[model samples]
Target: MLDHEVNRFNGIEIEAAHAPEDPECFAGELAAALAAWEEAGRELVWLRVPIERAALIPVATAAGFRFHHSQEDYVMLVRRLRPDALVPHYATHYIGAGGVVLNSRGELLVVSERHRRSARPYYKLPGGALHPGEHLVDAVIREVREETGVHARFEALVCFRHWHGYRYGKSDIYFICRLTALSDEIIRDEREIEECLWMP
Candidate 1:
């Protein structure tokens, strides 16, 4: 059998590095592996192929492997050995953060977005989506600076909301953080924000 990892469930994850360089060899090995896994009661199978191994994609597809998701460096594929087998979906939530910044003068910092579904100007907190591996405190501070060019530091996590069926049918978790402004500059991201100001 090809090199693999067994999880808690009746599933096996094939190692990409163990995959054969030749398509014919891979096909033969994969077919044999599938048969052995079926007899071994394996339900789900996961295979990740790096971009450099593009030639193996067609071979895998011919063996019933379907695309699960993709990344910059690799593509993941999955196959269910049994008819009623279950494979969970990929990451389902997008993370976001908003900053509630207050200055020493007791003024709140806010902004109006450049593009929106509504025609009328609607002012809101200055913040946006968090990057991968970004901390809540850092994300809130970064978002505030990126949106309004105001330097700020995290004070506390004021609130958060989780909603289903957001953009692209995925859920979203938005963190609202209270922050103290370090700078009062009103420079805004002209591409993203129409206006930005400090209101008392």
Candidate 2:
């Protein structure tokens, strides 16, 4: 039988490490595992298959597993044992911040991306996706420094925008934060930024 661990929802998780190498062996063990789990009153089953063992995909799918989500190294599949089983969704939203930086002279800091797809130079507030566990205030200030070498401090939240159909079918929430510039120098990042300057 395939070894599995119980999740918080009392679901069974068959990790990649415990999957059998041979597809035939995996199918048999998976069948047995399903029967056992059903008897144990399990409502849901999660299967994580590594890219290296992609051959087991068809076998698992044939046994009623459906694609849930995918990561760089593994594919997550799910099986609902009960009719009304609730499977937690993958990350549904992405959070980011844009900095509305203003200098003492009332000039606003803006940037044009180097790799923009649009014909016209896309000029906007300097900002980017927040790193995991990074606060919105810290992310805005950091983005300003990274895109255009300007030191800034958070003033207030100016505005925010939310839109669906963003990257990877996930919705995005972009916060516009007001920041006061402490430095006057304009040093743009060459990799992602093409032109950065203080706009009136």
Candidate 3:
């Protein structure tokens, strides 16, 4: 539990509890905390519960807590105790783009980074994060060229995913795009890309 005197809020952080436990135990504690906070004239009560603790969600909701937002491993819930308190809303913060380029011979364009921090090297699609003020279509086209040294035409947006618990500790907007290659020749960014390949 943390006390934010500056914000006039009491924050309760709940970790995952193993099963075969009682939800009533947590509910009782939450009830007591709510009563105390109400009596103290606090503006808000914040509860951070990890997604793994699926069991605690109902207990919190039953106490009038509303979903705020999720980051990394925790989902934040809040209960407003004051009418004048301000609450923040969600916004899109990051954009990541990649392309799935296939050749006439039914091969896919893939690349491996030189400085990957993982235990094993994993090949990825030929694309990356967008530059400042860059459009999504332009970003995908530029990334494919930079990583594979091949010119590609953006066809359509294949799919996109929202990544939480990412390495950078921020939400990521990952866009998977479909593109057609203009050339067979492969040139790679030596500083970022280690190898480029056309895999079946």
Highest lDDT: give the candidate number: 2
Query: Considering lDDT, which of the candidate structures 2 and 3 is the better prediction for this target?
Result: 2
lDDT of 2 by residue, 1-200 (tens): 68889988989998866778999999999999898898889999999999999999999899999999998999999999987999888889899999989999999999999988898996899999999899999999999999999999999998899999998789999999999999999888999999998999
- Each candidate's lDDT (Cα)? 0.91, 0.92, 0.78
TM-score of each: 0.88, 0.89, 0.55
Candidate 2: worst-modelled 10 consecutive residues by lDDT? 12-21
**How much lDDT does candidate 2 score?**
0.92
Error of 1 at 186 (Å): 2.0
Which residue pairs in candidate 3 have backbone atoms (N, alpha carbon, C) closer than 3 angstroms, thus clashing?
none
- State candidate 3's TM-score: 0.55
> Which of the predicted structures, 1 or 3, would earn the higher lDDT when compared with the native?
1
List candidate 2 segments past 4 Å from native.
none
Q: What count of clashes does model 2 give?
A: 0
lDDT of 1 by residue, 48-147 (tens): 9998998898988999999998989899999999979988989999999998899999999989999877999999998888899988889999889988
lDDT of 3 by residue, 1-200 (tens): 22223242343333434322357877877777667767877777766677677678888899898988887877788878776666666654688899999887878999999988886889989878888789999999999998888898889999999877665466888999999889889988999998899999
